[model samples]
Target: MKLCFMMLTDLSKRFNFMNSTFQMANGYFEKHEKDLHQLSDQIWDNPELAFKEKFAHDLITDFFIEAGIGTVTKNYILDTAFKVEYVTGKERSDSTISESDLPCVAFFSEYDALPGIGHACGHNLIAVVGIASFLKLCSSLKATGTPARVILLGSPAEEGGGGKIKMMNNEALSGVDFSLMGHPSALNCCTSTITQAMEEKRATFHGKNAHGTTPWMGNNALDAAVLAYNNINTLRHWMHPSMRAHGIFTDGGKAPNIIPDRAELLYYFRAPDKKQLKPLLERAEQCFKAGADATGCTVEICEKSEAYDSVIQNPVLGRIYEKHMENMGYQFPPKDEKTFRGSTDMGDVSRAVPAIHPWFLIPCGGAPGHSVPFAKAAKLPQSFKNAMDSAECLAKTALEVLQSKQLFDEMKRSFKETCG
Candidate 1:
């Protein structure tokens, strides 16, 4: 009897993969593959920084307008941010679909590029993934007149700026029921992270300026800076492998002959999760404070930018996505293999809503992200298709939620357990 039940469960999954809506989603992706590539290429061709993705923003918004899939709202929350919202469910004489029948879902796109390497992080592909995913789901919704809604949100400044965090503070994501996005990597995986909890810190040391020849006349801020650097280096010996605290002296002094009155240092601290992150940051703060105490220089330490939280992957949502990807013939890596995706503002998004940040393999020839080779690899044909397939699977996962209230409840329960 147990064997029969297992067999039936497997058959049900297979049936879901073979169903009409699944085909329709995949078909929409295939039909728009060229256009999708062009959009990604255009973003790659024109690299824009965070809060300054006007070109990419205008391009995507116009594309959505031309597609006529939903209502396009440009500059929705931030200057470069935009959203396309489609109400897929409505009353129809041929069907009994209702607007509130299913939970509202959202897909995110990040288009900002690194300053030195254009699209080196493969965010161009990320933008494509979001668009492709939304299109797939939107196509199915239109076809079946399903009782649900899907949104495509373009978030900017993900490279270093916390654009998503700003959007959340402004209540942009308040009403969204579920959120989904995928990142590009050398290997495909179900979760990018619990990625990492990360924060930026800036320190300014104040002291009296004195000639180098008269060393004892005034306090040396530069000395404090050096002490802080060494102290942080020392702290690393006791840090966990998953944690990071790296920094540099942005300002040392004007001349070798003078002891500068002011010095500045910038750092980024990261941990696997927020619990570990807080203590790591606190201990590191003491290291800086000790430097100031030793050098007799006053130190002011504060956040340089918005802090990003670690992602809490929704297990129930992940299982649904895995089945769809597996059915499409994509292989998963062993559980022990380490897939390192750096920090993201999407981590902040996950804390506010149930979310998944899957990583898909792009042909990078073993070059890690944020490099020239990875940037070139991102433009390859195969990379674009891989992103599309991942988007299709994400769309399938959304369809699963749209069909069952029980599934959405399970997702909510899992979210509470994982995040709390």
Candidate 2:
């Protein structure tokens, strides 16, 4: 009976600690709810393309500074990128615990909007939730005397530029123990489905120009471009169902009467993993070469951007997030259910450190992503509610990691075992 009493008492203390921490987080969010909503709405109103989010960069940075939060603008050598850091428990620290031993957790926010459609991917919501979560976590840590470090990374150009990839290369995540972010989607999921690795290439064909009357005098670059497109279409028959190869003709020809000297085709290659993506890329290149051979033209293929690796989810961290989200009345689909298949630079971050990029639901009135309807739905009341709930979930999960060394270690172990 004494042993039982001890166990119950310990459990009660833990429960109370967690409850107080959550209450503090809730209070922070409630206090700043209006400002966060305005930030989200303002970002949505002024949509900026990749690497050109000056307005968003200034808005968020100024907010942090005015609130007395430590911020580093133009972080990782990117003009639009920034970082916010908050530390607590230094004065109340236990003599036994060293400052260097505290775990550092990171949250990523992406604010760049898509061309023509503006926030069609709900990146505005992502930025708001990320900032709110970071603020709440900072407040919770200070109020509870928890010795922890929080970081919020303002990542840009996730649409195509791979800003996170550049940041990782610059050692921006050097001391981060874990990275967390959530994307807006039609379904709520703790783990995103396996995203295919992507490689973009541009093939330019060079040939001599000639008049239409003397076609024999010119090697038609347009013919080479057409052949390349056809070659890819034929290769698709032998490709895996998950593998995809698609291209667009950027320059077909000058005119019908004059044979063009140059033609260019841009192609995107995707596969289940980098290992599989390599051969597919090689095969696609061969198709381009075959076009050049048949048309008597020379071809140059250049990679458009760095390859995006498939996401390797850390299930240990995912379970903690799943529990918090479930407690918030969010229901996720079964694991076997198809998750939205989309590539992100966060995939690269996951491979580098323990990371979680869960998806939160935003009702789109039956519209899919990258659509006008979806962009409009980002401002709906339901979307804001979902964002706030997701923020709370992320904060709760981060608190668990900060307070429990065993849990943090397990997360790292799971990441190494599954990702490495």
Candidate 3:
């Protein structure tokens, strides 16, 4: 009977500690709510393109400095990328703990906006959520003496630039054990569908130009481009249901009366995984070659961007985050329910470290992503409220990972089994 009572008491204390930590974080966010909202608005008002997020980058890094957090700007050779670190726990006089030895948790902030639509993907909200969570965690750690390190990474060019891959090449996540961030979406749910690997291919067909009246005198490049498009379309019937291939003609011809000297088609090929992507790419290249052979036009295929790998959500991390957000009053759909499907540079980060890119629903009235209406939805009052809740949930999850070695170990084991 005594042992049972003691066990109950310990459990009670643990619950109290968790509750207090969450309360502290929530209070911190509430106290700085106005500033966070202002920053979000500022980022929204000035939408920057991939790798050109100078305004947003400066705003975030400056905010970190003002908050007394240590920051390193222009990290990993990316001009717009920055890193912020906050340490908490008993201060060690001797140099016992190396930077790499300490358990490091990372949060990614994506501020680059979409072209023409401006914040259409709610990256403004994403940026603020990551920053706010990091700030709140910093406060919690300082107040509670939780021995851990937190990093806020400003990852730009998530739209298509593969900034995370570049950072990985530079060893940005060398010592990081875990990475996390929340994406604003129409539904609040843990990711069920894995993002596919994507690669961009551009095929340019070159041929001799001559008068249209004398068709035999010149090879028609437009005909080659059109045939290539049809070939890809026909290849679609043989492709797996999960495979996606789409393209657009960038240049068909300058005038209708002249045989086109050159034509170009840009395509994006996506597969469920990188292994499958390679074969699909081979087949796609063959389609382009077939067009060249049929039209007697030479073809040049060039890779436009780095291939993006599929996101591998660490299951342990996902469950912990799902629980925290649900405890914060967010209802999530079942795993089998339909959810949004898209790719992110977070996919690359996950491959490098245990990561979770949970999606939090902003009250967007069911608007689709990357649209003008979605951009407007990002500024709504309800969206800010949801953003605050997401911040708390993210911070809470990070606290769990930081404070519990068993939990962190479980996350790592799961990452290796699933990701490997």
Candidate 4:
């Protein structure tokens, strides 16, 4: 590890010597700024839901192919989710360089949208950033003789479906030393502490149905669902500050005149970590049971999604990203008492490997995320600029990981030490 650090330090000096080259590389990407914005706008205009992003997947993958990066073995993973690799200086006459000998860096790109709002989560920005960064890095490496391999990860279904998780399970991230991705947000941050642990639950209440006029003869399923909701609402006051619970009635009652024979709901439960999640989930179940008992209804609670753990940031890699962004003329906002605390499937990936999912500030002012307004601004020119900026930063950070063995070793040690 120490020897790797020495080599990395030497490489860092070499990187510094290429400041002019870096400028040219960035300029190369800047030339495509207009096309990047148009692609982002097109994606936003036609949003696809989770696991069904045919348009987004095709657009991004086709762009990469046009950029000269070859697609890797992604059929092993989901069809929509694939990997693209760019290997520098494949010998004109001989080609026998093993992938293991080459340091691998990855950029995770998501392009799924919300049901009605479309790009509300700014996945369009994410996809454009990843593609632009990969292209820029490819150009830089080909020109500067940089010795590394760049991999772009096409991750889908971030809207509640575990696409990355499944990708990891399929060993798509194997042989990758470092992963880098950015989220479009209202403020800049090197690390996002918003990764809360999460669990999804679904419940259905069965009761007797009769005409509303003969209410005395019917057991109202709607009544049971309402009671359950109230119980969970009441439970919120006593839950830990880190704990969060919310739900919506999927089926309250079909008609006003008829008694509600069936009532259904989808509930989301969040905690600081999985250890705390267990007890909180149990309490929620008890509330469901209590509602059933009180309303004389039969209730069944089913776990929808497995508990997703909080994101674990690799400090070493995070600082490296911070350096890259600073070099690219960017700064993060001051840390506040109220940090971002959202939940994501990427948290699952962090648990298995060293990772960082930082938030890049879009032009959208401290606006509420995952909202319609946020979606609209995410398609603007300013958002495209920020996305391109993040792409460069993320690409540079990945380069640091590839060239600097010290950073990679520290990230590995940190991940193992923390997980163990």
Candidates' C-alpha lDDT: 0.83, 0.83, 0.81, 0.77
Estimate, for each residue in 1-420, the C-alpha lDDT of model 1 and write its tens digit.
111222223333544433676665555566777888999999999999888999999999998888666889999989899989887545432244343443588999999999889999999999999999998888776666555668888999997789999988998786688899988987778753447889999989988899899989989999998899899999998999999988989999999989888998999999987788999999989988888899999999999878988877788788888888889888778756665557999888888888998888888988888999999999999999899889988888887776555677788888888777
- Candidate 2 stretches with Cα past 4 Å from truth are 1-15, 26-28, 94-100
lDDT of each residue in 230-292, candidate 4, tens digit only = 999999888988799989999988789999989987898999778888999999999888888
**Clash tally, candidates in order:** 0, 0, 0, 3
Residue pairs in clash, model 3: none
What is the descending TM-score order?
2, 3, 4, 1
Q: Global lDDT for candidate 1?
A: 0.83
On the 0 to 100 scale, the lDDT of residue 397 in model 1 is 89
**What shift in Å separates residue 397 of candidate 4 from its native position after superposition?**
1.0
TM-score list, all predictions: 0.89, 0.92, 0.91, 0.90
Per-residue lDDT of candidate 2, residues 17-78 (tens digit): 56677675555566778888999999999999999999999898888877776545654469
The parts of candidate 4 lying over 4 Å away from their true place are 1-21, 24-32, 72-76, 89-97, 335-338
Angstrom error at residue 127, model 2? 1.0
lDDT, candidate 3, 1-420, per-residue tens: 111222223333454546686565444556767889999999999999999999999888887667666555654369888888776653631246555566678888899999899999999999989888888887776666555678888888988888888888888887788898988888887757467788889999999899989989999999999999999999998999889998999999999889998999999898877898899999999999899889889999998876798888788888988898887788888788744376777877888889988889887788888988899999987897798788878887887767665676788888889887
> RMSD per prediction, one decimal?
5.0, 4.2, 4.6, 3.0
> Any idea what lDDT model 4 has?
0.77
- After aligning candidate 1 to the native by TM-score, how far in Å is the CA of 189 from where it should be? 1.1
Better of 2 and 4 by TM-score: 2
